[model samples]
Target: MRSTFDFSPLFRSSVGFDRMLNALEAANRMAPAENWPPYDIVKSGEDDYRIVMAVAGFSEKELTITHEQNMLIVTSEKADEDEKQYLHRGIPSQAFERRFELADYVKVTAAKLVDGLLTIDLKREIPEEMKPHRIEITDETAPRQGNMHQIEAEAAA
Candidate 1:
């Protein structure tokens, strides 16, 4: 485990609870089950994402990707066959289980394995109400609009 600090000054802070910040901080603590298989995470778009893992010598049936309660779980296991024999075994047969903490609006969009890479895609949809709304301000209203009352009221509610 690693130690991280919260250096968020009170000046010019956000309005409500910082769930995304917490999620990002929590992400630093997440570690792979083992170092056997390396992986990569790529963001394709605002909501689209991809998680690619180097999975050599493992068939599609041997790998698994699942999402549970906003957490993405990946695991790979290969079975031993008596019919096959190997003169020298350089590749690893060990299994691995990795857990990734997904954001609030994030979801697994799709998953596919190709060319020894297990790719898992994700999507994030910001709720309609959660999206920012534009507030029109007139000359008169702009004079009295510098108060934090609205933010406080929203937090209280």
Candidate 2:
């Protein structure tokens, strides 16, 4: 039993959450998630992550990883093989494409394929301006000469 959601009320009261709201609507509209080509996302460090995908029969040349803005795309295409009779077919050969939405400042650092597993490494490189810095607390009697704006104000006076 699935229930629908109405976001009109949120739109009326919210100010700057358009992107989050759109993501929610997109998720609601998407089909049930597929389980093929199992993958795992692990947080290896404070700002590092890894994605490991089991691609049993895919080669390094057959896989492609792309990073665009805050999105990571992984696609695979199996090489064409001669028509051969087989007793049983269990492995999936059809092409597939998967997308992962990454957070701001997150970037793909490296990717490798080994033992039928595709591993991707990611790191978050926050800009200096975005990082927090300590601001010294000064006593009321302390001179405010350290501020350039204050110096300029005094020069104007």
In TM-score terms, which candidate is top? 2
Off by over 4 Å in 1: 1-33, 83-87, 136-157
Per-candidate total of colliding backbone pairs: 0, 0
| C-alpha lDDT values of all predictions | 0.79, 0.89
Candidate 2's clash total is 0
What digit string (tens of lDDT, one per residue) describes model 1 on residues 1-157?
5686663653238665576666756656666346668888898987788888888888889988889977898887778767877899988777788788887888888888889888898999889999999988577645465653653445565
Candidate 2 residue-wise lDDT, 86-157, digit = tens? 899998877889889888899999999988889999999999998999998878786677663633445564
TM-score of each: 0.66, 0.80
TM-score of 2: 0.80
Candidate 1, clashing residue pairs?
none
